[model samples]
Target: MFLIRTLHKWFGLVLGVQFLLWALSGAVMALLDHHKVSGEHALLPVAGLQAPAELLPLARVAQAIGQPIQKLQLKPLHDTYVYEATTPQGVKILDAVTGAPMAIDAAKARELAVGRWSGSEPPASVSYISRHTLETRDLPLPIWRVEFADKERHALLVSATTGEVMAAKNDTWRLWDIAWMLHIMDYDDRQSFNHPLIITLGTGAAWLALSGLILLFRSFRRSDVAWVLDGAEALRRRGR
Candidate 1:
């Protein structure tokens, strides 16, 4: 126990800076909007809808997007249905009723699109455009907007009228944005997890905590013994 406590204290002292950085970074990540890191648009919810149709068919909605919906949640917005969902390619917002895009516009689309091409040259060259991709059909309109943090500089706008993808941006994610992502993705076993730094930091923190607990127990015992001994000595001195 005593050994553990000593080890814990020393571990904390050694790794204190790392923990602090992680903490600060985590806090920033939780609060900072990834889309706004570059000092651009605000991340807003997809808006312009009222409420989702209670009896609507999920299959019909999936067909509207040409893919299976991973998850779908609906909320009420001004007598319309606003839906949030995820797909294999990305996260999305949708309109529960007609599925028309309502939430976003060209400006918001630019913000999401810019992040994806942050490191790339300005004037992104389209490597290829899939002709097979269908034009916007049954998807709802954007009722609100949201900034995503999956990648640098890229954000998505979900529609509020009919659940549809409105616009996206590609650009560079700020330094703080990357830092925040790393902080959240902490794991163990770098080769397996693919993020050695976060794993290393987490492991270091665990070690520090273990050492601290051991030290605390030892200190309590030592203090109790010392107090008893001091009391005995005072009694003896008075007797003498």
Candidate 2:
């Protein structure tokens, strides 16, 4: 019992701050609207596309690019048609009509953002990012960050290479993300929820709870309150 109590005390001291952080972060996450945090409210509706009369043959595109095309997709960015090819080497975007390699420039990225934006106002700014950051750690590098001047101040992340809208973020989403980082105890990358430190702390917390229960039961059995109750019952029985 002494050993268990000591262990519990030390573990509690070590994990108390983490426990508070988890609780606080969990509460904040639960209170915030999930849709807004996920940027669903800022998503633009997909427009219907008319089928083209003719398309460049996959074999010809493969021969020209000198790579085997594993998959192909026809994607429309703004008013232009682009063919996205997934190959063993990497992903490549080409002009759908002319079969020429197409690179997404800042102007094209801004145009794509405007087309996908759900807000009425145009984008406030568009900037190209060549490096990864905490918020965009999961996405591929060299992305376009498109910011809007809407009520939520939403920002859209567009892939410079794939020409795809990768993610959306607002102030609410940023707060939620920070809370999630705290709740998971992942401070470095803020992406992993099941790191070794968290696993160890979780195991310690469980052990502490079980040990506390055992201590409570032992104290109840050993206390004078139990003997007093027994004595009162014996007297009642003798009177009866």
Residues 1-240, model 1: lDDT tens digits: 656666676777767876676688777666766555543443334445534336357776677666667877776543356566667865565567676544435443344333332234332222222121111122243233334444443444344333344554434334554564445554321123346665676787887877666565655765678989899999999999
Cα shift from native, residue 100, model 2 (Å): 4.1
Worst 10 residues of 1 by lDDT: 127-136
Off by over 4 Å in 1: 1-10, 33-167, 170-176, 185-200, 221-240
Model 2 stretches with alpha carbons more than 4 Å out = 1-3, 54-68, 221-240
For residues 1-240, write the lDDT of model 2, one tens digit per residue.
Answer: 899889888888988888899999999999999999989878777677775678778777776567887888888766767788898878899878778898888887888888888889888988889988866888998899999998788989989888888888899998998998899989888888789988998998999899888888777753558689889989999999
How much is 120 displaced in model 2, in angstroms? 2.5
